[model samples]
Target: MSSIWRTMRGIIAATALLATGLGTVALPAQAQKVLHRGNGAEPETLDPAKSSGVPESWLQYDLFDGLIMPDGKGGFFPAAAEKWDISPDGRVYTFHLRRNAKWSDGTPVTAQDWVFSWRRLVDPRTMADYAYFLWQVKNAQDITLGRKAPDTMGVRAVDDYTFEVTLASPTPHFVTMLHHHSTYALSKANVEKFGADFVKPGNLVTNGAYMLAEAVPQSHIKMVKNPHHYDAANTRIDTVFYYPTENQEAELKRFRAGELHFTYEVPVSQMQWLRENMPAELHTAPYFGTYYYAPNLTREPWKSSKDLRLALNLAVDRDILVDKINQRGEIPAYSFVPPNTTNYTQQIPDYARWTQAQRDAKAKELFAKAGYGPGGKPLELEILYNTQENHRKVAIAVASMWQQKLGIKVTLNNQEWKVFLSTRDEKKFKDITRHGWIGDYNDANNFLELLRGDIGKQNPSAFADPQFDLLMAEANTTSDTAKRATLLQQAERLMIEEMAVMPLHFYSSRHMVSPKLIGWVDNLQDHHPSRFLDVKP
Candidate 1:
């Protein structure tokens, strides 16, 4: 009986060791499989040409192929195109396609698709708000403005697989721009098949690693792997589910309940608990963007006095807001462009550099200058803020500060995001509106270019300056990086000096992920998760 017991123990020990070895063994040829992703918002549209939201853009990247795509490490790589070349004058670009690439429909992807997609984007009839992104392409502005026909636009199909494009100038970032969803290709057949309903989940065709399996408006969206994809071997995930919960607390709850694989915006209130319990799961990255108060410069009281704007800018304590209201990892911003952005220099001069006490004094002096003071003539203004808790808290804090320091009565108006955007677009808000601008790319041009009256005129801010416009134009055309940086820095200084917009804080996003997830990296330029690169258990 003792001999039998010893034999049994030895057999069990050997089996356990063998199992451990198999678990750790590396396979040279077999590809790892499947990843599941959770999103905080439902995609508005899957059609690459129309999708503008971050969630939509993320899914679009996996469903469609662009001429070029960012590798999430600062460089652009060919996607549909196997190779590309630039002309000596930098006016023309030619793309060569890979022979193996094909659409999910099994049709050969041709240059004609590229030509059609480009023309469609710039067509005034399409009314693509994002068409401005393609301005570097030759004749794009002309096509958008109805000055030229779509065919006259400088993109053409040289052959079934070769595409050619002409640019108005030597844009070094042109390839990087192509990586954006605005440059994604769409099939003419799919467009015709679904017509206006092409973006509908069931009706759409995918050329990416996954296809939209289901999408319920404002609720959830699910995507399943595309077996017909060109690189199916690399695509591990069978399905991805997106839940559009706006509440940060609710997202964290779902994450803790094991219902969500990841949550992007962890609530500031839970930061301490998360740090103490699961520090390894927490991730943070500087978002290349700014949150600011866009004063309606074209309207009454605010428009009448530059000092009033300067006073208001000085009155708001950015440090307090960052530390108290937004406990999330946000940096106090003194300038429009976030630090570390390409072509950005910290040399830009800040206008309102007053300390807390000095700021209060300045606010009082400005109120008195405007013919209003504490217990005297009351200056009542409505400050608009988003419905988000953090935004509302910041608004309340600013409102309280104005009341306490400047003796101004500020009424806080909180609205849902969609309504707030619509109200701002209508330009009906004559006082001030809170807004945030997340960078579309890694360039300072993303933030700096928005302030240009040419772009802002359509959505005009209350303030406009010819000098600022001229400086930006000079910077835009100059190929020399140092010269352009200097010009942009000068323009930023002038903007802050003029009190054009009250710069508040630059965002830093935090995420909580399950231990099972891996290969995910935080992108500072855009917070959207790179679904293609991440792997899950």
Candidate 2:
């Protein structure tokens, strides 16, 4: 931090360059503020309209600016939009864009860009898992289903700088949802010119603090500061490199070797070792997400066998899995929604009060009833998860438990992130696949909507109970807080009773951050943008 230390460090760096015979030492120059980050997986896409996973959001949030952006306090504040107004009924919102806001190409970012991007989001022709996120908007669902025109889907450019949106009904958390990548605006001109290839590094015109510099599948993504960004003058991080380190152990090694300033996740396998050795670098905080296994209900007994579903769901010891495997301070999940969600009551499962022995006994009884235990034929189930060390450990533990207690064979299948995503969606009886869903916002609706009886890729369980769907629909229409909470609670209970998806553990962010990295604040959503971070000497 002292000027003398900085000068000495520069001399040491110059001496090292001379020692290596790379080049002659010259006048010192300003250091480039670059951050090498260990991203968990390769991003599926850079296009905001089609991005589905956290890895993709990490890049998209840096390259695109929505009307609002995360204020890093578990809430949103104006970004592209300078200010906004809401109607008294809260059914409509109008955002006033900054006249100075410009894309990476120096073109003005207008309200029309948002209108076009939103229309594409709900348009059936454009494939995206999060398209249904905008279903609360008036006619958005109808447009998605091709029952209405795209222009009729409730958003419009009132002028070059003013964007207006209308919802079918009042949504209290709608503004909060605007910070998600699915709601970010894109340049219509850029998309129209290059079509689907507009997201390529040389073609993309980003509006956020960074622009795509290079992209290599499975290797790394490079981004540099955008000079034309609205707040470019204040942006600190000049360059960022995101390495797809799905292997948590390898990622931690890279962090220890000083290759990465930060990591997406610290390997749970190395939790104790990290705590003992690098206590200052280890950053763990409560995260708004849930890890679970979704059964492929489109195939075999899973479609009709409630007993089979319940047996498998009740068999897993969530307590042991959380306490033993994930020592990163995660809570056992008995419900789909994470605990402490804003204004939402936690939905406890029916078997929550039962002892582990009682649950196991019940699971054995149900497995036998479903024709799979002592009396019936053997059942072999395969659990598919991405190639992450934590996932593998959890799968091996669960398989071992099932083999020991229930007298059934369990197979573990591991695939790369992209392949695993595609394989899980294949309509076959893949049995079960490991999945994690981080909340887009603080509302319980954000968590519950993943199971909505729709044909979207987000609904991996293929759960389509008409009664359960009705409860969620009613909750959507209910404006009163107490009534809505009751409706959502009933819906969550219904899903658990039916064993639609097996609940695992609620997430806690586990990252290893360098002490030199300043302005890295922890929040419920676990969102930390590179623009806000600065490095010290």
Best by lDDT: 2
* Candidate 2 regions with alpha-carbon error over 4 angstroms: 1-29
List lDDT for all candidates, in order: 0.73, 0.86
Candidate 2, 1-537: lDDT as tens digits: 434346657977876778578555444466667788888988878888887889888887788788788865566778988988989998999999999999899999998999999999999999767789999999999988889999898999999999999999988878888889998888899999999899998999999999999998888899999999878878888889899989888888888777788999988878998899889999898999999989988888788999988887788898899889788899988899998797888989768789988889999999998888776988888989988999999999888878888987889899987778878766443788898999988888888887888747888688888888899888988789998989988988888888889888999998999988888888889888888888886
What is the number of backbone collisions in each predicted candidate, taken in the order shown? 5, 0
- Against the true structure, candidate 1 reaches a TM-score of 0.87
Instruction: Please give the RMSD to the true structure for each candidate, in Å.
Output: 7.5, 3.9
Candidate 1 residue-wise lDDT, 108-202, digit = tens? 77888889888898888887756767877888888888888988888988898889998887777677677778788888788878888987777
* lDDT measured at residue 458 in model 1 versus the true structure, 0 to 100: 32
lDDT value, residue 303 of candidate 1: 74
TM-scores, one per candidate: 0.87, 0.94
Highest TM-score model number: 2
